[model samples]
Each structure stands twice: as C-alpha cells, then as structure tokens.
Target: MCGLDHHDDSLLEAMLENNLLFDSGVDGLYGRSGIFEDVIERFELLVRRLGAPDKATRIHFPPGMGRKTLEKSGYLKSFPHLAGGVHSFEGSDRDHAKLLGMLEAGEDWSDLQTPTDVFLTPAACYPLYPTVAQQGAVPDDGRLFELSSYCFRHEPSKDPARMQMFRMREFVRIGTPEQVCDFRESWLERGKTMIEGLGLPCHLDLASDPFFGRGGKMMAISQREQALKFELLIPVNSEETPTACLSFNYHQDHFGQTWGLQFEDGRTCHSACIGFGLERVALALFRHHGPDVEKWPAATRKLLWED
Candidate 1:
C-alpha cells in the first residue's frame, strides 16, 4: 500500500471520500477539493520565503501550444518515448470503435489515433518557449514569465506522486546566457533549501532527460554533456527509493533559436525554468506526517488551515 501499486487507489479513494473530484478523466477522477487549498497555502508561503516574483511574469496562457516548438527544442528528438501529441484520423470510425472496445477491456486507446499538430506537454515549459519566441527579440534586460499550467504525460507508473496529468507551476526566464545560467543556479540552492526546510528528507542530484528511442539515447547524451538539468530528490513513501519533486532546467539558447528569439546583442536568448509539481508535494506531506490529519505536526498542519 506504500508503493505505486496502492498509491493511486489510496489517494484516489481519499480524494473521493473528501469530495475532491471536480471532474472525471480517463483515470476515472480528476481535479481538487479543499485539499488543493491546503497545498496552495503552504506553496504560497514557500514561494514568498524563496522570493518568487511579486507577480506572475509576462503571461502566455494557451490550452494547446504548437508542436513545432517542441520539435525544435529537441523534445521529440530526445524524449520521444514520453512525449504525447494529439492525433486524429479520417475514415477511422471503425478503427476507433475497435479501440474503444479495447478500452472497455482496459486497454490503452491512445495507439489508435494518427497524431496531428497538437501534443501533450510532457513538461510545463513546452509552451513557454514558443510563446516567448512569438514576442520577437528579448530585451537586453531579459524577460521573466510564470505559468500555472496543467500538464500531461504517460508516466513510468501510476504512482500518485507521478501523475499522468499534474499541475505544474513553472517560472521561466529568458535572456543573455549569463543571466539564464545564473538564474538556474540560484534556484538550485533556493529549491534545495525550501524543500529541506519543509522537513522533507531530500537531496539535489544531476538529472538526465528520459530520451525517446535509440537515437534519443544519443540526444540525451548530448544534453548530459551540456549539463542541462537538475532535480531535487526526496523520499516520499519508501526511504529506499526517492522521487524527483522539483526540477530546474537550463535550455541554453536551444529554445531561443527554435523560436527565433534574439537578444539586443544579436545572440539567441538563453532559457531556464524552475518547476514545482503541486500534487506531488502534497503527497510528500501525507507520506511524511501520516494518514491521520489530526496527528500531523503542528507546524505543517497550521500551514494548511487558517481557521
């Protein structure tokens, strides 16, 4: 019951009993109840402690951003296995019917569609690059943007902490190479400090992107060579295995080139993001404190409820 085997079931049932289900999805339930309110209160306090932007940065809110940007960012080239895009086929009603039948039998129906221009945002930062690119050249001073977005993926497992669709509150900044690198490095320490302060046993680790295929393996190798990503790992359920709760990535002009984003100096703008998985953090709290809300630590419990 401590692992993914029962994680989804236990969390889902608890959420349901607590009336957290606002809608339903392929997974049978979705959305938040008062539970998210608890998570948000703590998150806001944490962000304030970390000196997050006083306001949401230049906003670009899109339901479905373009797929081409993901391609140019090497998303498809690197992590194709984890990437998901929208697909449709004409004259495939019969095929769709068969797929639906399989779904009724508990088989995945995603294989039936012919993917189109749309794609599932595996990471929250996917849409940010293209949106910023559309704005033309970045100012010499740089640009800062934040998006609280719902993102999707076919994850390694149905672990409650590793959801197929999760809320990601991401802060993105694009500008000179020096600025981007500095920003990312700064967050590395801040993120570690914040998580550690929350009383969660966590550690910082160099991260490698999960590449798509055999060729993707090569692209991931290149990313590693460039020292592109880092993640904060914490023990959620089992102390033997840690889960990545936060990840900071430095895109290093890769996205700027894709979106034709240039700097005042006529160089491609560098990019980086600090990502927070809201649900996973909540799950971490549950694991740390125990299932009974009454027995949870006073400091942690007070953060969630004002009344």
Candidate 2:
C-alpha cells in the first residue's frame, strides 16, 4: 500500500500519538520532534551526498528573503495569493500605545501591522537569481548552485504534507537553453530514483504552478502545455491527489531578463531547477514504511542512514 486511508487525521494523529510530531493547534503548522528532525537531517545528508559529485556551489539563506527581490521576480504578480510578506509594527510611540491598549481591551490590532522589506521566501531558488546576476556573468561552462531555504506560502491545509512553512533543498542551473533543458530532463528521473531509493512509490507528472486569479488559469495551462514544469508525486495524502514531493522547473529566459543574467558569451541565460520538499519526503517515509524508524525496511534504512 502506498499510504494509509487518510479520510481523516489518521496519519497526523498517529504521528502525534507516537511523538513524531507535536500539534501546534494550527493546521499545517506542527512542531517536529527530534526523531522527525533526525530523519530530515539524514535525508538531507543523502541528498547532499548524491549531489556532491556535481560540485554545485552551496549557499544558504534564512527563512525571510528580500521583498524587493521577490517583487522583481514577478512572484507578486503571478502568485500574489500564495506569497507571504513579512509585516511588523513600524509605527510611532502613540501607535505602540494604541496596540497595547487594543491587546488589553481584546481588540484585533493587526491593521496596524506594516509591510516590511523582508518576505517569506516562496521558493528556495527565488533568492538565487539576482544574486547570480550581481556576479556579472555566468561562467563559460555554466553555473550550478545548491541552495536551501525555509519557504512560506499562504495556503493553509489540514494535510500534513502541505505545510505553510517548509524547507526545500534545490539544485539550480543557469546556462544556455540546451543546458537548462538537459538539467531539467536529467533530474526528472534522478529525483524520482532518489525518492524511490527511500522506499516510497512515486510517479512523475506534467504539472503547473499555482498561479492566482482568472488570468492565472491561462498561465497554469500554458505552463503545462509547454511542459515547463513537472512534479514527482507520492501517495502521501491520498491516491487521487497525491502530494508533490519534488518539482522540476524550466524558466526560458524569464529570470534572465528580469535579473539581467547573461552568459560569458553575452547571451541571455536560461535556468532550470529541481526542488525537494524535505518535510513531505519524511512524511512519505513515515506513512509508507511505518511510523517507527527502528522498524523501517533494512534497505531503505541503509540507503538513508548508512554511516
């Protein structure tokens, strides 16, 4: 079986009952236990080990990325519904006193919150573009970067696999069109194999990003029709609508134009990226292989936990 019958909170309840995760009272927001964290850490180690041969330049960023960068990426226009901008109290002393009074009087004062320059990064690769453009030109041979970030989206869900805040480990490639396409095509199989190596049944499907609004319908359809995006789905939540555990995307000069990325030959660069949802992978492991790590399949255990 791919996963338990998840008509209710059976899996979430089981994990909570077993101390694998702690309820945060909010749906899609849970405090992971140490055991859960260990699994994620070891899985990331496996990802790094598998990707190490590529010599990707590793970079890390905090959960919040520059809001200006996000704006320039066209994310605000395309996925405004899902994007999350950090807001803070940027008011004067009188405003602060009013906020305190509101709290004391049981009034909602969130209206006083001000938008900050930092936004919760929607994707791991969002912050990499402008940073690379700032470096002047892509190397002659091309550029591959290893990046990971805590990303946020506004979608709240009861599905444990779909968290509002999650971490994505991504490998991004920027180069000629051929190079970018090849990178995306290669990873479609590589990512599936890696997930299967962890003993999860997975399949690849042409997919589209969750673009917002009526106009976004056309955008999503166009994305799928162009075969620009794909997802590696696992039966974590249910069979009908399985979870997207990993995603592969190809941006044909979109980011290049936006960020002014250019190759050493002065040609516009194309980019591709493959991202792994670390939490969903762990959840898949737990859902399929049983909650207790001590009793997991020996082969899967060896693949992920071997020293």
Best by TM-score: 2
- The candidate that wins on lDDT is 2
lDDT of 1 by residue, 206-289 (tens): 777777767767877787787898888887644666778888889887788777889867888888888887777776766666
Which residue ranges in model 1 land beyond 4 Å of their true spot? 1-33, 40-45, 53-63, 88-116, 302-307
Candidate 1 lDDT score relative to the true structure: 0.70
Q: Clash totals for all models, in order?
A: 2, 0
In model 1, state the lDDT of residue 197.
63
In the range 182-301, model 2's lDDT, one tens digit per residue, is 888888877888888888888999999988899999999999999999999998866678899999999999999999999777799999999999999999898888777888888889
How many collisions between residues are there in candidate 2?
0
For model 2, the run of ten residues with the poorest summed lDDT: 1-10
Candidate 2 residue-wise lDDT at 170 = 97
